[model samples]
Target: MPRFGEDYHHFHSQPEPSAAYSTSLSSWAPSEQQRSLPPPRWSSSASWFVPPTRLLALLLLLTVALQPALARALDEEGEGSGDGGKGGDFSVDMYHIPKPFQFVETPRDMQVIEERAASFFCHTSDAAEVSVQWRKNGQAILPSSTTASAEDVPGGSVLTILPKMKDNNATFECVAENALGDTISAQASLTVYEDNANAIPEGFPQFRLAEMEEEEPDKFPVFWPLAIEVEPDVLEVNCEATGDPEPKIKWFKSMRPLELKNPRYSVLAPGRLQIKISREEDDGTLYSCMAVNEKGVVFSGVFGLYHLE
Candidate 1:
């Protein structure tokens, strides 16, 4: 043991080991063949002894076993010593991505026609493959002669339909969708106008005149082939309304509703109600006119009839 300790010192301090020392150690060392032989069995009395290397290895293993538990204990104690709110605080861990999609309602300015029609404009940040369909009373529109089809629009899509072609009053809808999600617009009513040519002002567009004939006449249908002539100073007004359920017309002269009994006025037809007011009196004035059925109302463009005379 003394010799081995002295040799370890010389290995670090001396310049180098001579080849003679190597030769002497090689001659004294056991050969690989001899070392491979089984170690001699230890007696019961010798079993108590442990090699220094084995003792050191055991000590290291024991230290490793205690370290993790000690670390956990220190962590627990530190956490208990501070604010409870800070103890459990952690960053938000998002688990899953959510779908993105939204909807915009159809413009109220749209005139409801014979066929049901509403449009939903979809807005979304994500690009997606989308499909939109309209359903009424929870029934899908199928391939049919009168059934309206779904059309694609920018950033989304729209579905149009004639919910019930036979009945002038069917509910309509607009639906928009994309791969991420779907959105729906509220129900709307359709107005199927039947043409009563006599009821249309004679000068009104030919297409609109045809609409009056579509429905059975409720009252003596009247038509105005020639809209009454008006001077530049006069404000001329005419109105026509249609609906599954018949629509009514209300006229306002300036801010007040007008009575047709005046000698200056004549009611030629039910729908072709006309009004003439001198521009010298009514210029720069705003008038409100509305057409209404059970389902809804449509207001007309503001009319200004006169300038400062």
Candidate 2:
């Protein structure tokens, strides 16, 4: 038999064994086969080893097997390390959250005369450690002559205003702030009325008196006087006058000032004086209406009442 060489077997096909020898191949000695057969050779290049498709399949299976474990590890890191997650170190409890600011008492609208003092009040609930501030028309209010100051009270703050003409019809509000956030109260209105009486001329009772009338008369006499006829009943007279600095009116009976506190006597709108007189002594009583301003005082002519009984 030809000696089997590594290159010979690699290049050519081996001869077929005879039937009689093939049936008795197991009877051959292992030492004789080991001495006779040349050492088997393996390809040094990797290209002859495994198919590309099978290698790719194996890598894909390995990746699929490890996917769940990788995802679990990432989830644990996110939960335990960073902020804002439920299991995070910096997570905040829902029950222990800081309370948001709320208004307990809001400021109310008010009116004041010029140069008068007014105060606005604002309170908040759960205001501990929170800061309160005052604002006017969305701007912060500062201490000045017009705005006196703001002070803290028991549960809130009070803003004092020395009202001036420029502050008329201004809106004010209160703001409270804390770590959580800030809240604003409803706006309060401030109305300042003008004080024209302060600028009156330097003269006592420097005013003019116009002709008085009780009822319409068809003719005007040189000396027209106001007269009225009434039974023992209620009497009302309206005395309308206009003067600088807005005049104030008063009524007198027999040169005596009328007592305003008496319920029987009333002063009505447009300077009308009403008296409940149901006595004989009130007949022919001299009644006069007087208007006074900062400048001076003026009186209406005495009106005589004739009793018709």
Candidate 3:
């Protein structure tokens, strides 16, 4: 028997391979010749088809590259063209954006006869997302059988309260709230008047100003100016009167009969004219209210309304 090294040399030296066998072996080996040949049809088609993992990686790169361009397009569409520009077709729902509440009109100072119903209104710029509540003397007012009742109205809220002598000089305010923050309105006061026990027998209408407590029950009319000058928002000009038959009230502006159509100018109640002042045209305008019954017609003293600078 041969040694291990001797046996390996013996196997290698056995015989020279045939020409056909040598050719076949060289063709099967990895060499330049194998590489030079055209690939099989199946292999060429499979090379063009990408693998799942590599395809996903390419998609991620494309998305990242396009992100900045998409953002710029959206911003350009929303930008305003000028002061009066109405932006693109895609309108942002203003309701989604949080905005602080603002007041267009606040409650006005009121004077009402004892046992009569008094209405105080609060108007807001945008009411879709705003909530309103009425307060009395810095405390929240809730609805009850004998207490003030608050109700939601178009663009704002209304508070109705039946007053007694105890309610005189009570301060009232309205608070509005929205997603961003809340706003508190300027305070207004309520003045309650009691019936006089020593009343003269009422025959004809006699006019009395809100500042005055009483008037002589006469058939003739008298007038007085407003107690103080006030700025815009809401103003209640009241003309109190007494008569055997209740008097019908009418309001005038600049010495002419006021045509009350819009909510800006309306009578909140008899003898009480409520005006929502907004335009420059309303400045320095004289306002007066009249009380009329079958006996006679009485006009209150004229007062001018001006918008503060």
Q: Is candidate 1 or candidate 3 better by lDDT?
A: 3
Q: What does candidate 2 score on TM?
A: 0.32
Candidate 1, residues 43-76, lDDT tens digits: the string is 4235366788999999999999997886677667
The all-Cα superposition gives candidate 1 an RMSD in Å to the true structure of 20.6
Residue lDDT tens for model 3, 1-309:
334444445555544544423466556444443345443233323435677898999999999999788766756665656533334335446657644467788877775545545567688887676678788999888766366777776557767677878998999998887555665566788876563323223454556643433464421224664623245377667776777688877676654546688678766677767778765867888777666565434456678876666
Question: Which pairs in model 3 have colliding backbones?
Answer: none
Better of 2 and 3 by lDDT: 3
Which of the two, 2 or 3, has more TM-score?
3
TM-score of 1: 0.29
Off by over 4 Å in 3: 1-100, 197-309
Candidate achieving higher TM-score, 1 or 2? 2
Q: Go through the candidates in order and give each one's C-alpha lDDT.
A: 0.48, 0.61, 0.64
TM-score of each: 0.29, 0.32, 0.37
Index of the highest-lDDT prediction = 3
Worst 10 residues of 1 by lDDT: 202-211
